[model samples]
Target: MAGPLTSLKVLDFSTLLPGPYATMMLADMGAEVLRVEAPDRVDLTKVMPPFDGKISTAFSYLTRSKRTLALNLKQAEAVDKVKELVRDYDIVVEQFRPGVMDRLGIGYETLKAINPRLIYCAITGYGQTGPYRDRAGHDINYLSIAGVSSHCGRADSGPPPLGIQVADVAGGSHHAVMGILAAVIERQQTGAGQFVDISMTDAAFALNAMAGAASLAGGQEQQPESALLNGGSFYDYYQTRDQRWLSIGSLEPQFSARLCDTLGLSELKSLALSQKPEDQQRLKTALKDKVAEKTLVEWQEIFADQDACVEPVLTITEAAEHPQLKARGMVIEVDRGDGVMQRQIGNPIIFGVKT
Candidate 1:
């Protein structure tokens, strides 16, 4: 039942979200991960709210399956210690601004000199060789810079701030994991490791592939909530009679036709892909009025056996307890020692071995 990454060892010097999440995934896959936290600058999540008997739930979930080592890197002895450890560790994941690791004398060049097979991944807000490299930014700033924020939310209300850190987790953590794994495979063939420079901004920009493709193909920059996928068409969330939300994603021709048939609005099917703004708005209003005639649960039952892609929107709590998610084992209980059991979201990867 050993995981695929059981043979690897990782040294993690990242704090907060991105790098920690990448190493956490490695640890979940049975890699030996040593998380090094500085005494002066502890990961802020450790002190964050919602603590369980002095353990932050955020930190507990993120740092699971990893060992911790506290060290003050301001001292030369700590730098030398890391250098010694780097010789044995297979990969190193760090989240520091550009030049910070170099200033500490533990940059990629210094570590690669000691261990040529070391896979060094550096995750930053903007990359090591950009004008904004040294600029400090969080997930929101990165998303804004990548043009992702400009296309979110309704046109009338402008772009609403996202509740989740999409740029940090998707852009940084996912990309870092991908880059490190690819480097590991490449090293086996070439017998040499390489530096992975990951920028949150760059990763977020790459996520706009569909929008970027349209722009490159002579389309204008899409406005917020004005694109088909961004809520322009009839494929959107509608409020039910009970004020609860139902999501309709009948994008395909067949699905749209089925939706029209379900609602007894065959006349509206021809207006599904209407290019005229007025027609689109009229269709949206019709769909909205139709949806408002039923409660969310009623619509859920109505679409239970259909393929129109209509679904009731669930709250965060409801989502965790969803029957489909429960069947898939997306929610799991983890022991944090001392008989402390915490509920956590399970890893999405479905390897043959147990997680």
Candidate 2:
């Protein structure tokens, strides 16, 4: 079956997580993606562990459904070959330091001259033009700069989040993909392509929209785990008797009351009163005692029939093997050219066509 993006072609000159992940998403949707890898630069995913001994499981997941071209752009022949490829490709995605592409003579300006209809997306830590554009940074630094890290962990701890790669995946990869798709749509109308400069820091800033609004309205910069969504007893994670955790999302008073009723804590239902400072603390204490009374399985069964929005906190492995995930095909096994197969998170979109 033909995929939604079967007609599109992408030349991906990106290494590591963000760019590769974005291109991989497009490739999963049947976009003809040509990943340009350097012959000398070892694929970092291959260097890291959790491999299948012969091939990197991480690399296999990200590079699937795409053709790999081991090209060293420093070579004169490679440059000419890339130029020729640029003429036919619909989009070119490069995630390099600010000046690296220009130094290699494959910058957006040069590529756009060759193919004015090309959608060129450049992803970087900062951006192509900024005071700190040349500064090197990773996901942590970008999140810190965007104030995303400040709202991450527990109120008493200064530690950062470990689960979400907000800057790389959410900020960089998703932002670049959105920009490229928008550019593609705009190109159809204007018959001309444009440069999409995606700054990881700027993309991360998008996540701080709510916090920024709160700050603008004279609210203090709340502690990480003390915010309404983060700390409120009715809205956060709670540990049960079995040591497993369950998440409570009773943000509304009615839902919180329903949750309290389900847990047989009618007296604690009053804890779900207005979100005032004192009331929030009372709710936290009440929820702590109430949730501790049951195992995670018990709580799951208790809230199963209710719309109190409660769910067990699943580990990564458990989440991957979840029934809903299995039914939706969210976890798929892909061949990595070796004898072994690699498990990967599947594309979330359900397209009418397939490739």
Candidate 3:
């Protein structure tokens, strides 16, 4: 509890990944987060199997360093208890559908009235308004609706299902944390807190990033495997002879030159940045063939000292054991509240302060 946000307190009323993940990050940075869960509610993370001692392994990972309380919000006493807690826990995070909190008599307006300086953040799928506001959606649905699926994966195969929950963690969780922190800064100046609206879909829609810029202003509708970075050029992944994937990101002329020369196909260096579809495809074919000739290990040894940005696509276990990641302290063991210690991925944020 020695990080930058040590003085901050949070009351978490979120169920699944987005809200819970946000609170986890806040707790990691030394915020005092009190998780208020309904005793009868079935949190997937709590009952999804793979137990760590007495608690769910996923639950153990997500709820680390946070105090927990169970309350049935249907009871007036529970609502009053929450209202009482709000006096000190000035920041509130809830993931219920819009109006559900209002109906429960513990919404932002109600709590904000008690503490005019309360920072309330609401995270939902579509948002507090719009036709899809009340409609349910998962990470894939949000990403699909946001046009992220349009230009990912092979054009013939459509978009591949990603292992990660891009919308939930990246879109909802990250954005909620950013919004809450921004609101905190604003409150410092105004001496009054405000509500933060975080819609997973809205947030995912904005993650299109440079591709979106192209479509909106350049009037270029990006297609699957059609863009420079996506998979159109040699910047994509190539399968090694052992079926292991190698990511070739030799985008710059210097890097691609090094890549072409090191692979003994220096003649292709001129075509590395070719915009013509035929030449780009040809260059890709040659690089793919050359890379496929070697096993992942063989290629790794060849490029061990190369600055070509070529690297092996590692599994999670391999990644955890990688020298660079190990040096960066990306994995650690933490107590699971039951005093049972387990290894989990460490937070990626590099904080200068000890926590």
Point to the candidate with the largest lDDT: 3
TM-score against native, each model: 0.96, 0.95, 0.97
- lDDT for model 2: 0.86
lDDT of 3 by residue, 181-246 (tens): 999999999999999999999899899999999999999989988989889888999999999999
1-355 in candidate 2: lDDT tens per residue? 1488898999999988999999998988889999999999987976776777667777888888889999999988988899999999999999888878888888888998999999999999998898989999989999999887777677677756566688899999999999999998999899999999999999998878777788768677756766777663457888999998988888788888888888777787776776577877777778888889989888888888899888999988999988888888898887777656778889998966543
Ranking by lDDT: 3, 1, 2
lDDT, candidates in the order shown: 0.90, 0.86, 0.92
Q: Look at candidate 3 and give me any clashing residue pairs.
A: none
Backbone clash tally for model 2? 1
| Segments in model 2 whose C-alpha atoms lie over 4 Å from true places | 217-220, 352-355
TM-score of 1: 0.96
Better of 1 and 3 by TM-score: 3
Model 2 poorest 10 in a row by lDDT:
225-234
TM-score of 3: 0.97
Say which candidate scores most in TM-score: 3
Better TM-score candidate (1, 2):
1
- CA lDDT of 47 in candidate 1? 91
